[model samples]
Target: MNTSNMDRCLRAALLGIGLALIGAPAIAQDAPVEDAAAPVTESAAAVEPPPPEVQAPSLEQAYQREFAFLQGQKADLERRLAELQDRMGAEQSELEAEIRALEAEVVEMGGEADRLEDRVFESELAVDTARENTDVLASTFLQADFSLAEAYSPDLGDRAPAAEDVSGLFDAALGVLRDAGSIRVEDGEFFLIDGARVDGRIVEIGGIAAYGVSPRGSGVLAPAGDGGLKLWNEDTAEVAEALAAGRAPDSLPIFIFESTATEVEKKGTKGLFDVIRSGGVIGWIIFYLGLLGLALVVLRVVFLQRASASTSKILDAVSGHVRRGDASAALDVLKRKKGSTSRVVSAAIRNLDRDREHLEDIVSEAILHESSHLNRFGAFIMVIAAVSPLLGLLGTVTGMISTFDVITEFGTGDPKLLSGGISIALVTTELGLIVAIPMLVFGNLLSGWAEGIKDDMEKAALRVINQYYEGRARGVESA
Candidate 1:
């Protein structure tokens, strides 16, 4: 039995035992008291005399009776408990069966819900696909309508049908396509290259190309920006005449076009000066500075060339004369030579009889004096190099300012309005770099070369002194 049923049976058994015990105490209390005196009454006293013979129940007898009663109650409770347990068992079986059936139903319902969910998802996907297809169809229809209107007939503007009327639009587009496939000749007045209009037979080979035949001139035709034909500046008169006569020419000369509503102008190449002029005043200043820098470089090159001429040969000849103990001849050779090295060597030769320290000081002084000429224009060239890029940056800042000013005034609607400032910005920067790079490179190189010449001069003067001292020592040794 279940716990609840067992507890109920136990409680019923306890209640039966309690009731038997309580009834035994009540039966003992109801017995007549033997020691108590009977009330005096003639008939009652006679009847009480007979009642005195009645025996009260003994303790053992009373207990035995109570036990017997308890036994009966217990049997009764056991019967009731057995019936309750049987009823409970049947109910439990029924409840378990119902629970199992409910669980099966729940499982079936869950599977159905899953299937419904899948169907819902598939339906949503199909709905989205249909929406996308409709959008594609609408977009394609609108684009086709625009292309037809622009390429074939300007008068067919905005003639798009409703979304449901796709068949009608397709029919119209197909008819226009068929018409555009063949050559058609029409009497029209077209403009010539010189802007003169003349009556002509315009032969159109599809919507792509056209040719004109006229008495004044006959050639291939181009759009004149007014939905009219104009003569192209090409020599295709024979082809135009052949098309006009309905004969296929050996070579087909035609001008293909998309629309005649917009004029097509030929673009010309920009020259160097035109490009420089586009950079405004700053660009021109940079350009002139570049020219001046070039001139300075040339002058510096010439000066350095003259200063370093025949340096090695002069040094060799002077050293040879000094070694032969003829200081006068070496001095004559130095006088004849013309260079910073020569001047330095001559000073050394003149002071050959002096102490070594004095001779060295004299040579250093000569080198320092010649440096004034060797280093000429070097600082200026470097300054120009350093300043050019900064000037370019200045031009760029001004150009950007101008560009922003244009934007502030006109709201940036047209690119052409802003292109001028942008050109100035870019061109000035490019020109600056172009001028500065080579100047910087060549200026450093020239400075290095001048320093090399000075080193050579010092070496030549030192060699002359060394040769003189050696010759004197050799003479002393011979003495």
Candidate 2:
């Protein structure tokens, strides 16, 4: 039998035994007294009481017992569950407390960060305020110094002083004056003052008006509406000569005031002339170059621009007068004419008997002398034209250097910062070309004209020789 079968058999035997013990009657199985036992069975049965019988339990009692057992089990389960719940709640409380502590730490850290940020912001503000104070120019009247008389009561005249006290006072005043700063500048921007439009204290002279001398040399205070400088002649307003607008040549502006009169120190104006001189070196060079070219042009116009008829007029007049037997008139005409041809002809006429070939040589030499005088200083203009552009190129090199410096210092993000060097480069080049072109062109043109005149002089000298000396040779042959 398998284990399950054996177990089942055991459980069945136990159940049957319990049932037999509870309900079954006892049976006698003896053999000696069997007849006796058998004859006395009915009476013994009555005398021996039947085995007491057991009844089945009632359904109500069984149900009550089962219900009580289940109730006890449920009570034990409730006790265990309550213990587990209490342990879990304690753990949850500890975790929550830890979380609260961490949150408080985080809040404290955040407060520290805010405090540091506030300190940084306050420091930055202080630094910005300091920088602004340093950079700002004095912008209001409160920053300016008031005059001594304005600051003090005007009773200095009431106190009399000894000679030593006066000297000491003068010395003290001088020291104060020496230590005093520059005159206060006015904030001249247009602002609404009272109700009228008034300009700043900028002095200007009028073109249409004249200023007479001040009366008794008093202050030149003029009223706002009348007796002031006239911009133009008008019938409406009562106008007079006074300081007015516009800076014209030969105009002067006089400023006068009570209390005290202030003037611009003009401290930086002394170098104005030097600045102009430095900037104008190129201009001076160009001007001198032009003047030199003009001089050469005048010389060429004088000697080279001579009339072609100069020799012919004299030669024709001389031949005509000679045909009429008027040698004196012919000589007079020759004397009036200029240039080598007339001179040679006049010399030949006067010398008459010299070797004709030698006289030709003399005329040639004189023509060369006149050519030299015509071309004076003509080469200098050529040099100026050649060098001017080179000078401009030098300026361009310097400008590029300065331009790179500006880029390094200020950066090229804005083109206006670089424009100054560009102006220098471009303006110099333009001026150079402008100056060189005229000089180069006119200088060569004048030179070519001088050369042509020299050639003409040579030709005229040969013609004069042919007319005078060649004729004399033919005359000797005729004789």
Candidate 3:
């Protein structure tokens, strides 16, 4: 049967064999004992010992029977085991085959699923592409309709077809484009420059430009902040008339406009004063400070010029006088001469009788005194240079503050409101830099020039002192 039934039968056969083997020896022993215990049962003993064939089975025979039975049962169990093994092998093979079949089916399904998924993905992609193309078409139609409406008329009305009618929209747009390219004259009323409305024949060269030939005045046409035309310039009357009469003018005086709903005013070039005014009060203040700095620079230049005048000639004259041992003449020459170099040389000459160290001290003192005039306005000019940028920074801070204030009040909707403050901020800073840079450069240059003048004066005085001493030495040697 099955493995479980075969296993039960094999266990039962083994248990029976074990019981027979265990009882066989006890049965043989008991039979002999019983025969002996019978005492006068000699008849029974004799009857039992009558024949081996009629005697009870001995333990050896019983064991041989049990062994034979056990052998038979073992043979039967072995046969059943073989049948179970064969059945199990068959089942295993069938299961393995089934498993393989299922695995193949699963693999096939996986490939099919992959193919299906690819197909689904492609379908989805196609759908998305179609949607995108539909959106593009709709947007194109809307844009075309809007462009046509804005260029030709305020409302498309029946001229613009439905959004779904793409061909109609394109056809209408093309027609409008063709019409716009050619000059078309139409009877219309337009406003003159003096705000008087007059009937006119409007000559439209294209969507970009138009010209009006009115009874009152004929010139180029511009948008009047309404769906109407206005006289832009009276000088273009000839061109407007030529276009109206279907004559091509040699020159086109055209006022190009994008829309008739908004007026475009020609912007004038701003002068220096207008730009400065746009910077507000701070900008004006910076401008004035720049002027002040410039004036200071000029004053310092004049002072330095006067202080440095004829320095070489003064040195030569004093040196010649000192060389001749005419100290008094040298002093007279110094007195008549003007400028820092002459004064320094005079101080050296007056102190010629003194010791060398003392004469040098006098010359240095004279040079120092003249340096005050040479350094005049230099510090103020530098101060202006330093202050101008700081004022600019202050103006910048104030301007930004005002800009923020405007933003806070108006919510930054109109850029014009914010531009004023921004312009002030930038203009003030620009002006400040413009003022500061030159002032700083010139201030440093003038200071360096003043230092150079002082050096020259010291050199002139030293030359005079050397000449005086040399002359004295010669005079003393001659004596």
Q: How many pairs collide in each candidate, listed in order? A: 0, 0, 0
Clashing pairs in 1: none
Tens digits of per-residue lDDT, candidate 1, 1-479, equal 35566556655666665667667755655554533444557787567555344454555565566657666767787888899999999999999999999999999999999999999999999999988887776676667767766443323335544544666567678878887899999999888888899998999877888898999998988888879888985489888988889888897766789988877666689888887898889889888888988998999999888878768888778777898789899888778888777888888888988999988999999999999989999988888898888888988998999999999999789999999889888889988888899889989999999999898888878888888889889989999
Q: Estimated TM-score per prediction? A: 0.63, 0.37, 0.69
Ranking by lDDT: 3, 1, 2
> What is candidate 2's lDDT per residue for 193-301, written digit by digit as tens?
1223333332222212222222112112222332232111122111112332222325333333222222212144535334323323553454455567667667656
Error of 2 at 152 (Å): 65
In TM-score terms, candidate 1 sits at 0.63
Candidate 3 segments exceeding 4 Å error: 1-121, 144-164, 316-320, 336-338, 355-358, 390-412, 473-479
Residues 1-479, candidate 3: write the lDDT tens digits: 45576567656765676677687777777887796776666577567654453454555675577667756767787898899999999999999999999999999999999999999999999999987987776567668757877543333344533454765666777888898898889999898989899997998777778889977899999998878888999998999999899888999977888889898776899988888898889889989999998999998898788777768888777777788878898888878888777777877887788998888899888988887888889989988899988888988898899999999999888999999889888988988999999999999999999999899889888887888778888989999
User: What is residue 250's positional error in candidate 1, in angstroms?
Assistant: 7.6
Candidate 1, overall lDDT?
0.83
**lDDT for each of the candidates?**
0.83, 0.54, 0.83
Backbone clash tally (model 1): 0
